[model samples]
Target chain A: MSTVLLDGTEQLINGLMYGCFYALIGGGFTLLFGVLRRFNLAYGSTIMAGAYAGLIPVYLFNAPVLVLFVTTIVVSVLVGLLVEFCCFRFLRKGHELAPLMTTIGMLIVIDETIVYLTDAVGLKYPAPFGDESLALGPFLIRPDYLAILVVSVVSFSAIFYLLYRTRFGRAMRAVAERPDAAQILGVSVRHVNVLTFVLTSALAGIIGFFAAVSVGSARPEMAAWLTGKGLVVMVLGGLGSFPGAIVGGLALGVLEFEAVWFLGSSYRDILAFAILFLVLIVRPGGLLGTRTA
Target chain B: MEYYVAIGSIIGIHAMLGLSVYLVAISGQMSFGQQGFFALGAYLAGLSTALWGLHLLPALVLGVVVAAAVGLLVGFPALRVRGLYLAIATFGFGEIVRLAFLNVRYTRRIGDRVVGPNASEGFRHVRYIYDRGITPLEYLGIILLALVVVVILFYFLERSKLGAKLRAVEEDEVAASMIGINVTRVKVFGFTVAAGVAGLAGGLFIHYSSYIDHDMVALPLAIASVTYPIFGGLGSFVGPLLGAVALVGLTESLRTLHGAREFIYGALIILTMLFRPRGIVDEALVLRVKGWLPLRAARRPAPAP
Candidate 1:
């Protein structure tokens, strides 16, 4: 019984750490979706771009870890703007499928570019928090895991404060609730949309930085896995609900970790997807999602 | 050569994929998960033929049936969901299917010490119809026959009462409901039909390739299928076919150019959205050059009607 309790506690800690990545990815997805009203299929690719961006600076210049994080975030912001200007901006008011198709195309383009640059080989990166481990009773926790959790919490709080307390957040909410009305009321919907993309992409970059630390490797295919999982998390949380993303991410993380613990690592993803499918079938709007509109 | 025959069959497989997307999109619902069904069909067919010792035709049929069943199960909930939520649900379903294939112990059939009937046993020999020294022209003939059958079936269905009802529901669910059309039923049926078509394509693809794996069924392929129909115009039956030919042809031609092909696809999609939002088949648009020589040209004055 004591052994089981120890195992459970360890699993719980692991789940919390894993949930941090999901939360960051989900938050970025929800933010963009809220303001753009369009799903960006290339979102995962942006995260990969961020990871590579962070790595190149670290490897080439022997830069500080902080600089790597900042560089990645900035590059992701630029990429987001590039996607918006190149693929989305012109089709903002067009048919719904237009932008979706454009983004799908963008995903392929970005993925192929990454593959070309890296020769489809996975690149290893130095872990930001070093290889130090801390033990709590029988459970051993890595410093990187703790750092990831801290970063996720800080990022989520920052986003929440920005969304609720800032004037720009109010304008964004206004645009999301009613674009034409917001425009009539002197809000620049275009500016709001662009800013939202930049912010969301930057968040994805930060998440990428942490993900590289956790996995100790960066690859083109990293984005593909996250994109699929992130989409699931976004849907399971509710499409446009900010708080729902947090709840959904945490739930998914915990559940997936427990599954991995019991069912072996191979079956972990299977269990996660089963839960996703069940959630979609049972509660399409996700927990805490408003039914209005 | 045998290589030409192989290429032709692959094209046929892609054509089937494009048609599945076309059928779904025409009803105003977008699915980015057809590749999941395609993978399911291929894997099931391959396993049945190679491991279960089933005949190729029977295995193909069973594979398609299984795909349709899975599609119906997913479609029930999907029919009720709308917009981005529906898209996400389908996307999630696809991921679940992929992960299930990856993780399920029953799927792996090699190097297990367990004894008895339930023990993991690897696949062995499997045969396809095209293995009998069939020529490229014969394969093309078979493909054309299948294409004709699919076209006729879709044409009749799209012109039928059920198809009209589905279209009505797509246009306006509230209005469709008010007119006594069962919107839910139409949506479910539409989704099921789309799935069935995709299942058939998947089965055909497996038979054509005679080999299958998880990577074959992925999101990029799904996205490609979706893009084909839209890029071709999506206004008529021929649109997706045309789009598939252009896209596949372009990709193949640029296969040796490193990453340029994908870049072109991305650029094409962006350009299409910006300039020809309606697609290349715009009836009102045409390019013409007037006679360059002004010397011997007769100038006509405007006449009052």
Candidate 2:
């Protein structure tokens, strides 16, 4: 009974840590959908790009955590801009499926590029974070987990401040709410779009970096799950809901961890989406979304 | 010659998949789950023939039936969600199905040998057709015949009430319902039939390749399936066929370029979307091309009645 109790507590803490990270990733996806009203099919590929970029400094120059974070953010922003120009900008808005197709094309391109760069192999992180764990009584939290929690909290809080507390944020919200009206009112909708893409891509980059840490390596080929989970999170939280994204992301992480706890880990991926599918049927608008026309 | 036959057969299978995607699009829905149906068909057919010594024809039909049924099941709830939600839900469905198949344990026997699905090791020795010694050319002929049959069937379907109903729903679902067209039914029917077509393709694919696995239907394949219809222009059935042929041809030709195939696909897609947002073979473009044909020129009304 005591062992089970200890295991449950440990799972809870670890799940919370991961939940926060998932929230960040999900938040980024929801942010894009909120601002752009289009799904970034290349979201996962950009996350992979960020993860790969994060590793370059560590492997070649033995850069510190700060360098990795900065590099990932910058790289992700660039990729986001590229996607916006190459896939999204030229697309005719409100077209049935043009944007989606273009994004998928971008995803294929990025996936192939990463595979070519890495020779279809996984790249190990210089900072493995496997050897260190913070112990408190009967629970042991890995350093990476702790870092992920802190980063998630800090970034989300900053995002909250940005989205809710700033003039630029208000401008962004106005554009998202009514792009034409905002444009009429002299809000440079384009500026907000660019800013939103950069900010969300940076957040996705952070989440991607943590994802690589959790996986113990930067795997270009195996990075599709980040996008899948992000999609699951975005939908669960509500397509254009930020707070919902955070909650959905955390919920997905905890749910997935609990699934691993109850069922075997081998089938956890299957159960994760299966559960989300049921949720989608039950709550089509998600926990926080308004029904889209 | 064998290599050419194999390539032709693969192209035919992809064309079928592309058509399946095209069907769903005609009914105002998008599905990235055709790959899931494809996987289901392949595995089910493989199991039927390998385990019970069923004939390939029956196995293919049965597999298609199962795929269509699953499509209806997935499409029913999925229909409630719109656009992005539907796409994601179907995607989730595909991943779940793939993972479920991957974790299963199933087996069948050959002459003094047993083979089956082996967790991550994949399903092996699906050699029923190959073992029967049907040549690749014969296989190619068989698939092409099926494609022709499907084309003819749909050609009639387009003139039928069901196709008109589907087109109505695609134009406007509320208006379609208002006009007593049964929008949900049409949408579900489109998805179901599309899945059946995808399943038939999957059955053909496994018999051609003579192997099966969970990863056989994956993200790239699913996305490629979706892209074909869009790339070919989803205005009509021929668009997907044209798109599949051109895209698959491009993919094959680019195979020799190390690390450049996907980049080229990406670049082409981007350029196509920019220049030909309607795809390379939209109705307008087709009419234009047809006007230049020798037969159309020859039948030019002779400047009199």
Candidate 3:
């Protein structure tokens, strides 16, 4: 194989791995928005919290990778519930902006809390997969990156199947489509909403754990960068569309990396935003969003 | 004297920032991207004056023009979206602008190179009447006076047909469209006007500080602007102004407290949302306060009888 082909293949694989991470975040974002119809600005912070939560078990007791991951997910679920209780539950039926603004307020609180907890220090987390690179034909991928990709795909697929095939999944879709109708059909709307929030936060937390493992470090400000990208990916994929988010996340990941390679890394964000702007202009409903609205 | 001047200048600039947020929130668009426009305006003004050696007035005007032009470009897509989508799009735009400023070679490397028609070497010596022998207090007073005039004008505009149309569009786009109002055009106009105000504030900020950086136009400032309208009560015309003054004063007071300031700031936002969701200047509260105050005074005499 040619050297250029090998590099391209490697870049593509890397992009896919990163794309999987984004998909997880984007999926969580979409799920929350679908259920509540409110943007949770604190979602990114939850991810960060999850990373720190996972780091605690790993760093303090030198826990195995699986234990760290479980801890992260559990912590994220609690954080999500806390946010919903504090910011959303009371204001659920109020103006849409009420919960939205409250979430933004929560974001600042969470960020400050993290900063205070960490003593304003940046902490590093060791990857369970260790520092090993695996060779696949002409392409070389880190074991951890491959693991993240596989885990994300499986998790997302599981979510899709649950949402579509299970009785609970049917109820969720019913609630998403029409709350009144769902309630009439014996669905506990509030319970479902809370469950959705927990589910989304847990997913974000798992992603955050893997993300910290991938980056090999955790910091107070780790989630700030992810906030905008996750939001953009959610929007570009069509707000509540599960498939749309997956496609959008992958496309964005590939495009961003490609832009970095070709136009210099500095211009990567500009290119990403330009693409987002154009997509918004050309297709306001997103690539797979329902055009009926 | 310089210290006094700096204090006055900061207040004036902050008031301008407050008013910029006011203009957008009044029209029913909660734009947290004003900082982006503000930064653009400041950068344009600073570049034209310091680098291109333009006269201060022309530099200010040019800055406003540049900021408005960029606003128009961004606003076109914004007009098609609203709610969280619009907020997210504008947020993305603001981030892009910040990144571009940080990464763009020319913006960083240009380093006060005089460009355009005002590149004459002796231009720095020229002074406007406003700058000539003006005391800091007097300068501040004059800026406040000018702001008052602008506010009055905006007040009237809010009560005028265009303002009504803008409000109607905001309240219910479908109803506004049914009534034959151009929803898109009105929204774009509201966005442009808001952008222009932000630009004006930015230009003034640069002149006041004599410095410009990408940090000036980031998300924190945007969040501050958004919080102002919410805190002041979005229903009233004076809400943003009051909110801004209160928030700015509180922030200034908290600054001396060090690390706790941020936590306090976050708490303030949450508490305001929880307790006074309609803001401090709700019409019903004003009326109730008025009625209660007069009754209390009258009750003392009645009790004696």
Candidate 4:
């Protein structure tokens, strides 16, 4: 009984740590959706491309962790901007499905390119935190997980500050609330859209690099997998809600870990999807999403 | 000769999948999960023939029925959601079906041969075509016959009242409802028929390949399936068919490109959207082609002054 209790606690802590990682990944998706009211289907692929660009330094010159982060963020932002320009910018507005289709195309292009260039091989990356565990009164936590948690919290707080306390955040909010009204009020919707893409891409790059560090390697399929998980988190957290994303991510982490503890490893993905389906059905608005229309 | 036949049959199967996507798409709902129904049809049809010793026609019918029923079940719940939500819901459903198939281990011994979906190893020895000694040419003929029938049906549907109703709903659900159209019924019916069409394609696919695994029906397949209708244009019934033919031909011809085929597909989608927007075959092109045809009724009569 005592062992089971310890196991449960460990699972809870670990799930939360993983949840933070998911939240970080999901943040970009939700942010884009919140501002644009359109899904960026290429979100995952752009991040994957950014991570691949970052990996170049590691493969060629054994770059430090900071260099990796910087390269990933810069390349990711550039890729994000490219996606916005090519897929989102020129298309006529009100044709909702067009943007989705274009982004899906962009996603395919980026993902296939990564797979081709890497020859589908998983590559190693440097991690800031080594594989060390600290025991705190019968609870054990890994250094990498702790680092992820710290980063997730700090990043989300920064996002909150950006959204609530900054001028740019105010313009973004205004645009999200009503593009026409915001435009009349002096906010350039196009500029906000591009800036939002940049911000989210940088966040994705950071998280992608962190994920590579945690796993010690990045594979071509990681982009799709991360996208899938990020979708689950976004939906669970209530579509475009930032606080909801954080909560949803943590909840998903805890729920998934507990599910694995009770059932098995295979149940992890199944559980996430099942929850997404159910949430969409019973409450399409999600835990934090308000039903639009 | 065999290679051409195989390619023709594969194109037919993909065309069927494209039509299925087209059906849902014409109704204004974007389902990225038609592959779920496709997989269902494949597995169920494969089971009936491989395990129960049924004939091909009945097996295919059974696959269609089961898939349509599941689609109806999905469709009813889908009524509550619209736009992106519905797409995501369907995507989740597709993944669920894939994962379930990954873990499903139902096999039975029949005359010294174990047959069924054996977890991830995949269901093998579908043997209907193999056992009967049906030539690849013969199979291609059967596929073409099926494709022709589906095309004719879609052609009629494009002119049918139900088709108009679907288009109206796609334009605006509230307005459609206000105009006394049963929005729920039309959407649900579209989903059901689309699933049936997808199932038929899947049944054909499984028999041709003689094997299937969860991975084959993954997200990539779903994307490829949707890409057809979008690339083809939504203006005419033949749009998806044209899209499927063109895209599949490109992929097959570029087989030696070593990953560039998919890259091209992605680039084409972006370029098409940027330039064409309404796809390569839009309403205007369809009108122009129809005007050139010798059919007397193809031309619209001028308004009397």
Candidate 5:
């Protein structure tokens, strides 16, 4: 009994640590959805593009970790801007699925371009911190996991500050609430939309760098998988809720770890989608979301 | 000869899938889980013929019925959400079904060989057509027959009163309800029929390939199934058929391009959406074609929705 309790506690801590990553990714997705009322299926692919771009300097010049991080954010911002221009900017006010379908097209293009360049092979990614673990009372925690938790929390706080404590954030929220009214009030909906994309893409870049570090490899296929997980996390928390994304991601991480412990690795993804299905059924607006439509 | 025949069969099967998407799409519910119904139909139909030693027609019927029944069960809970929520919910449903199949490992010994789904290793040796010595041409004919029957059903449905109700719900649910359109019933009915048609497509697909796998019905298939209707035209049932043929034909032609095929395909979809957002077979195109034929009264086309 004591051993089981120890394992459960360890799992809980580890799950919360992993949940930070999902929170970061899901937060980016929710931000985009909140501002535009549309999903950029290419969001993960844009991040993947940034990661791969960062990898080039590492491969050719063996750049330091900071250079790689900087490169990733720069490239991610550019790719995010391009996606907004092609998929969202002009296609706005068209059919409901127009932007979605266009993003999917962009996703395929980005993923396939990466595959073509890299021959669809995974590349080794260096972790910022060395591979070491800290033992904390019957638990072994990796240093990188700690780093991820810190970075994710700080990032989340930064986003909260930007959203709530700034003039731009107010404009963003106004646009999200009512685009026409915001336009009438001279919010420049286009600027808010572009800026929102930039913010989320930068967040995605940071998350991607951390993900590549923890996994110790970068692959093109990660885009679609990340997109799926981000969507699941976004819906599980609430469609357009920010805080909800954090709570939902953390809960999913914990539940996923428990699933892996009780069942097996094979059942991990199943558990995620099963919970999502149930949440959508019982609470259509999500755990922290108010009912809409 | 055999290659073209096989391509034709695939196009027919995809057309069936596209039509299923069209049915659900016209009702205003954007489902990303029709592939779930397809997987169910494929597995169930394959099992009936391979494991139970049933005939092809009966196996296909069993597949359609089971998928349609599950669709009805799914439709109620699914009806609670709208727009992106509905799309994500259906997407979750699709992932659940796919993952479930990934873990399922049901097999039995038939004669001297093992058959049935073997988890991620995939279900193989579903050789009902091969065992019967059916040729590729004959299989293609079978698929075309199935497609024809489905098209006929869609043709009749397009002219029926329920079709109007379905479109009415798509336009505005509140107004539709106020007009006594029974919005819930129309949406659920559309969902059920779409699942059934997807099941039929899967039944034919497994027979042709002589294999079934969870990965085969994953996200790509779901995306392609929906893309066909949207790409071809959403104006009428004929749109998906045309879309399926054109897009699949493009895919087959681009097979020789190696790495460039997918890149070009993606670019083309983007370009098409930019140029013709309503798809290749919108109301304008239909009207223009009608004008070419003699004795047709020219009615002004409805502006693109």
Candidate 6:
């Protein structure tokens, strides 16, 4: 194979790797949009919160890298519940725009809190892969990325299982499909909302760990961009559809990576957003979204 | 004082941006792309002066027109989306515009010397009018004049039939359309005008500082624009103006706290949402204040609560 072909193949694999992570993150965003029917802007903060949660065990307890995953999940779930109670529950009866404004406020507060707690500076994530890679005939794939891909795929499958095979999944879907009807059927809407948020946020924790590790550092400022990427993935896939999020995320990941590779690196975000803007224009429902009307 | 004059001008410029958001607020849409329009206007004004030697007024007007044109294009499809989806779509447009500018390279002449605008460096020597020795006070006067005109326009718009139609759409889109008001037309028009005003503000901002850059119009700026109308009260012409003044003042006053400033600012927003979701100034409050002023129109009997 020529050098260009090899580079192209490498870029495709890199994009796919990123797509796996984006899918994991986008699932959490879609879950909130699905169950609550609002953009939980705090989702970004939760990702950051996951990173900072690891800060405690690593710094205070001098814990090994193994502690990071547990801390991330635990903290994300707590933050998820906190957001549910403080930002979401109160505004349920308010105007349509109320939740948006309030959530934005919540995002700022959470961001600031992280900033205050940590210096809000970048910290290196402890990668466990140790620079290992498996070389194929023409391409070398990093085990780190493959690990993340495996983890993402497994997590997504687990989510599907939880959503499809479990009793909790039925109750969660029941709430999403018909909240009042679900309530009449003896499912507590509040419990379902909180529980579903916890599940989704736990996924965010895993995404957070992998993202910071892959990118080499975690910074509080990454929240907005992460949120935007998640939104791009969520909308591009079709809102409220996990399967669609995975497909859209993979496509978006490749599109963004190739945009930087072919065009200048700065053009990556522009291309992603341009596609998102076009998607909103051409098919508001997204690639895999069912036509509403 | 030059310092006070500069601060006041910044407040005025921000007020114009706030009003841009306000226009869309009344039309019942949540748009977060005014910063993109502002950047567009700033670049246009900056480029016209640097490259083509256009005067201030024409450049500003041109910027406004172009921004409005882009707004129409972006809003044509975006107006079909509502609430959160619309906000995200506008945000996507905003990021696209900002990134496009960041990637665009500009070469220009500055007093017999050639300079290039880099990826993030933006354009300098923007205020050719200022280079001709327009004093800060004079520039502030120009901005104040423009603001007064915009405010007066908003005031009249509040009382106008079309304004009522826009408000009607905000209150309920289906009902407005059922009553024969063209909802799509109204929304697109409001978005276009709003973007034009933001572009006008962008022109003012770059010229005032003699610089233009892409970073100045990012996501945070868009969020700030949204905050203005919501914090001040969305019901009246004064809402965005008041919100802008108060928030800008708060921000400036908290400058002493340094890093804590953003935290405090965020806290204030959360507190405001908690305590005053209706905002600091609503219809009743405006009415009461007007009642105390003793103007003829203000002297009308209070309606029964």
Standalone chain B TM-score for every prediction: 0.80, 0.91, 0.79, 0.95, 0.94, 0.93
What would the TM-scores of all predictions be? 0.90, 0.95, 0.88, 0.96, 0.96, 0.93
Candidate 6 lDDT (Cα, whole model)?
A: 0.84
TM-score of 3: 0.88
Off by over 4 Å in 3: A1-6, A291-293, B1-15, B106-146, B282-305
Instruction: Give the whole-model CA lDDT for all candidates, comma-separated.
Output: 0.75, 0.84, 0.75, 0.88, 0.89, 0.84
Which of the two candidates, 3 or 5, achieves a greater DockQ against the reference?
A: 5
Q: Per-residue lDDT for A203-268 in model 1, tens only? A: 988888887778889877788888877877787788888888888888888888888787788777
In model 3, the Cα lDDT at residue B277 comes to 68
Per-model tally of clashing residue pairs: 0, 0, 1, 0, 0, 0
Cα lDDT of candidate 4 equals 0.88
Off by over 4 Å in 1: A92-94, B1-4, B47-58, B103-125, B135-137, B278-305
Per-residue accuracy of model 2 over B63-107 as CA lDDT, tens digit each: 899999999998888888877888888888888878988888876
Best by DockQ: 2
Model 6 ranges off by over 4 Å: A1-6, A116-120, A291-293, B111-116, B283-305
How are the candidates ranked when ordered by lDDT, highest leading?
Answer: 5, 4, 2, 6, 3, 1
Candidate 6 TM-score to native: 0.93
What are the per-residue Cα lDDT tens digits for candidate 4 across A48-122? 888889978878898787888899999999999999999989998766767878998999889888889889999
* DockQ per candidate, 2 decimals: 0.58, 0.71, 0.45, 0.69, 0.69, 0.53
Question: Candidate 4 on B1-305: residue-level lDDT in tens?
Answer: 78788889989999999999999988888898999999999999999999899999999999999999999998999757878878888989999998999999999987777789999888888989989998889988888888898888888988999999999999889999999999999999999999999999999989999999999999888988888888898888788888899988988888899889889988888988887777777778888887788784646586799
**Model 6, residue pairs in steric clash:** none
Residues B163-259, model 1: lDDT tens digits: 7886777678899899999877777777776676677677666556554455667776787787777787665556677777788777777788877
RMSD of each: 6.2, 2.7, 5.6, 1.8, 2.9, 2.8
lDDT of 2 by residue, A1-293 (tens): 58877787788788888889888878888889888888888988888898898878888888897899789889988998899889877776567677787888899899899999889899886554665778988788888888888888899899899989999999989988999999999999878888888898888688778888787788876557777778898999888999999889888877777778867798678888887898888998888888662
The Cα error of candidate 2 at residue A130, in Å, is 5.2
